[model samples]
Target: MIEARQLTKRYGDKVAVDGVDFTVRPGAVTGFLGPNGAGKSTTMRMIIGLDAPTAGTVTVNGRRYAQHSAPLREVGALLEARSIHPGRSAFDHLMALAYTHGISRARVSEVIEMTGLQSVARKRAGAFSLGMGQRLGIAAAVLGDPQTVMLDEPVNGLDPEGVLWIRNLLTGLAAEGRTVFVSSHLMSEMALVADHLIIVGRGRVLADTTVRDLVLQAGGDTVVVATDDPAELRRVLVGPGVEITGHPGSEQLTVTGLPAREIGRKAAEHGLVLFELTAKTVSLEEAFMELTKESVEYHAASTTGRAA
Candidate 1:
C-alpha cells in the first residue's frame, strides 16, 4: 500500500502540490488523475524519492521509500518512458538494472517476454517506437517483481491493441494482490480500468473514492421528459424530495431523485402525453469533466473545443 499524509511540495513562489492525503491499496487498480500542471508528476516524483516534499510525508508499505532496505523489490514505478538510455538495447538496459539488484539474467528475460518485447529485445531503445518504449518501461518497472507499481500515462502512445494489453496487464498485476496506481488524463480509459480513483486538481485532492461513488456523488440517473406542457410537469414534479429543472428553452423537464419508470407512471396517471422520456445516467467522462472543469489550467479555443 502507498499512503500520503498531508503531502505537500512547493518550488519558490509556486506551490506545485498542496497538502494532500490519499492511499493506494493492494488488489485494486487506483487511478491518479489531474489536469496539466495539476502536480501529478510532482507527487509521483516525491513518492519515489526523486523530489523532496516541502511539507507532509509519504510512505510505501509503512516506510519512506529511502528507508526501505530493498526499495526496488517493494515498489516499482514507470514515471517516464524516455528516461531510459536511448543508445542502450532494451535487453542491456534491463540487464543493467538486474545487475544492480543482483537479479538473475533469467528474470530479465522473463520480463522481456512478459512485456512483449522479445522481438525488439536486442534493438536499441532509441530506434524503438513510442509504444515499444512504453513496453520497455513497463518491463523495467516489473523487473523487480515489486508488490507496488505506479505507472504514469502508460497508454500515451499505444495503439488500440497496445492499450488493451496495458489495461489487462495492470489488471492482472492488481489481481495478483499487487498495488497498481496508474495516472491518466483519459477519463474513458480510467473509467474502464480503475476500480478506485484519486482525483486531484490544483495540487489538491478533489475526490478519493470508488468510480461508482464518484459518479453517484456527481449526480446520476437524470430523467429527461419532453412535453408540450412543461409547466404542468414542473408543478407535478415540484416537491420536497424531487428536483425539477428547466432544460433550456425546450419544453422538456429534467427530473432528479425519481426513477424513469416512476416518472413515466406519474405522467401516465396524470393523462400527460410525452414526446420523449429517457433515463440518462451520466457517463464517467461527463462526470469527470464536470468535476475538473474549474480545476483545468489550460483552456483552448472555445470554437474548437469538443462538446461534452
Candidate 2:
C-alpha cells in the first residue's frame, strides 16, 4: 500500500503540490485523475522519491522508497515510457534493470513475454514504435515483481488490443493483492478498470471516493418516466426538492431527486398508468466535469462555425 500524509512540494516560489493526504490500499485498482497542471505528476514524482517533498511524508509498503533494500522489488513504476537508452535493445534494458537488484534472467524473459515484447526483444529501443516502447516500459516495471505498481498514462500510445491487454494486466495485478495505482486521462477506461479514484485539481485533492459514488454524487440519480398523461403524472409527483422536466407534448418526463420505486408507488396510488420507469446512470466523464468545473485551469472558447 501507498500512503501520503500532508505531502507538499514547491518549486522556487510556486507550490506545485499543496498539502495532500491519501491512502492507496492494496487489492484494488485506484485511478489518479486530474486536468493538466494539477500537480499529479509532481505527486507521483514525490511518491517514488524522484522529487523531495517540501513537507510531510509518503511511504510505499510502510517505508520510504529509498529505505527499501531492493526498491524495485518493493515498488515498480512507469513514469515515462520513452526514458530508455537509445542504444540498448528491449531485452538488454530489462536485463540491466534486473541485474541492478540481482533479479534472474528468467524473470526478465518472463516479463518480456508477459508484455508481448518477445518479437521485438532484440531490436534497438530507439527504433521501437510508441506502442512497443510502452510495452517495454511495462516489462521493466514488473521486472522485479514488485508488491506495488504505479503507472502514469499506461495506454497513451497503445492500440485497441494493447489497451485491452493493459486493462486486463492491471486488474490481474490487483487480483493478486498488489497495490495498483494508475493515472490516466481516459475517463471511459478508468470507469471500466478502477474500483476507486483520487481526483486532484490545482495543487490539492478534490475528491477521494469510489467511481460509482462520485458519479451519483455529481449527477444525482435521474429517473425517466413515460406515461400517457404527462401533465397529470407531473402534478402527482411534484414535491419539494424534486425536479421534473419534459419537452412540450412529450410523454416522457425526466425526473431527479426521487427513485423509481417511490415514483412507481406514487403513480400507483394516484391511479396513473406508467409505460416506463427507468433510472438513468451518469458517466464518469460527466461526473468529473461537474465536480472539477471550478478547478479546471484551461477553458477553450466556444466555436460558432468553421474558421475563415
Candidate 3:
C-alpha cells in the first residue's frame, strides 16, 4: 500500500505539490494523472525520496522509501527510461546493480527474459532504442519482485506491440497483489488498465476515485429517442425537469432528466413509436476532460502564440 497525507513540496516561492492525500491499495492498478506542470512528477519524486517534501508525509507499505532496509525490495520505481549507465552493456548494468544487493546472475537473466530484452541484453545502454530502454528500465524495476511498483510514462516511446506488452505486464503484476501506481497521458490505455485514478491540478488533488464512479459522475439522465411522431413525443414527455430538444425540425428528441425506460414508457403511453431509444453513456476520456478542464495548467490560446 501507499499513502500520501497532506504531502507538499515547494521551491523558493513556487509550490509544486500542495497538501494532497490519497491511497494506493494492493492488487489494483492506480493511475496518477494530471496535466503538464500539474505537479504529478513532483509528487512521485517525493514518494520515492528523490525530492524531500516541504511538509506532510508519504509512505510505501509502512515506512518512507528511504527508511526501508532494502528499499528496492519494497518499492520498485521507473522514474526515467534512460537513467542507466550509458557506457555499460544492459547485462553489465543489471549485474552491477544486483551485485550491490547480492542478487545473482540467474536473477538478472530472469528479468532480461521477462522483459523480452534477450536480443539486446549485450548492447550498450547508450545505443538501445527508446522502446528497448523502457523495457530495460522495467526489467530493473521488477528485478527485486517488489511489492509496490511505480512508473512514470512507461509507454511514452513504445510501439503498439511494446505498449500492449507493458499494459499486460503492469496488470499482471497488480494481479499478484502488488501495488501498481502509474502516470501516463494515454487516456484510452488508462481506461483499460487503471482500476482507480488520482487526478491533480495546480499542485492540489482534484479527485481520487474509481474509474466507474468518475464516468458515472460525469454522466447524466439524458436519453436519445428517435420516434416517428416527434411532436407528439415531445408534448407527452414535456414536464418539469424534463427538457426535450431536437424536435419539430427533425425525427429525434434528446430528452434530458429522464431514463430510457421512462422515455420509452412515456412515448408508448402517448401512442408514439420509438425507432430508437438509448441512454447516452459518457466515455472515460469525456469524463476526464469535463472533470479536469478547470485544473489544466497549460492553455492553448491559438495558433497565435507569437510573431512567428
| Number of the top-ranking candidate, with lDDT as the measure | 2
Give lDDT per model, in order: 0.91, 0.94, 0.90
The residue pairs that clash in candidate 3, if any, are none
* Model 2 lDDT tens row, 202-282: 889999999988987875589999999999999998999799999999999999888999999999999999999999878
Return whichever of 1 and 3 wins on lDDT.
Answer: 1
- Candidate 3 clash figure, as a count: 0
Candidate 2, clashing residue pairs?
none
Models 1 onward score TM values of 0.87, 0.89, 0.87
- True-structure lDDT of candidate 3: 0.90
Tens-digit lDDT track of model 1 for 195-234: 9999889999998888887776677767889988888777
Q: Rank the candidates by lDDT, best first.
A: 2, 1, 3
What clash count does candidate 1 reach?
Answer: 0
lDDT of 3 by residue, 9-102 (tens): 9999999999999999999999998889999899989999999999999999989998998888899899998999999999998898788777
Residue-pair clashes per prediction, in order, are 0, 0, 0
Model 2, which residues run further than 4 Å from truth? 226-254, 257-271, 275-278, 305-307
